[model samples]
Target: MAKERSIPAPMANPETEPFWAAAREGRFLIKRCTACGKAHWYPRACCPHCMSEATEWVESPGRGTIYSLSVMKRAPEVYAVAYVTLEEGPTMMTNIVECDYDSLAIGQAVQIAWRPTAEGGPPYPVFKPR
Candidate 1:
């Protein structure tokens, strides 16, 4: 297989460490606001919905539908960037991989696939068409 394309490691902080840690373990997670019962990505201390500071990390179902996509044919390797709307209703930015780039489409079903990167901090979450 081609070397996995990598994004830089996220700088883990107290609030987001749980997310980074889970990624290292080949799992995906999101922050769910305890007060508002809303799930969100880009882990944070406060809920974007109700502005509540109460949130907890929850395992993501690791499945989503492609909300949008852009193919990078000129890159060293063909790749796609996409916003995947997760099953729990949060849209997260991720890459769509392991298939022909021309085959991807908006609303295509996808599932998370962890890829180890050069950064070595945590394997990043990309997706494969489901």
Candidate 2:
């Protein structure tokens, strides 16, 4: 059987194209608001906090703590999805890798890692124990 493809392609948009481009180059980014000194994720055109349109893309520290997680045991094989709260204040949904499924726990420290795709899309960011 062939491996499943998971990477996502870049979306051509004025607000988020740069983000995808950078990710393709093996970088992770988060949106930071200059006016309000706040950071956000999912790449928005404006700051959700202060409603400021002045925002810039900044590289994430890529370090976070696992806020929550769930383990899968069925047809999908074994996998874990976690809500990681980044040190910089953004929570992202990512898969936890390089660790045993039974060893995962809430509040565990993890770091971002990239998973390249054969389909030529932007690398998917997953987490591993720090």
Each prediction's TM-score versus the true structure: 0.91, 0.87
Candidate 2 lowest-lDDT run of ten: 1-10
lDDT of 2: 0.84
Question: Which regions of candidate 1 fall more than 4 Å away from where they truly are?
Answer: 1-4
Which 10 residues in a row give candidate 1 its minimum summed lDDT?
1-10
lDDT of each: 0.86, 0.84
List residue ranges in candidate 2 displaced over 4 A: 1-12
Error of 1 at 125 (Å): 1.2
Give a tens-digit lDDT track for model 1, residues 26-117: 88989999998999887899999999999998998799999999987654567788999999999988899997788899999999998876
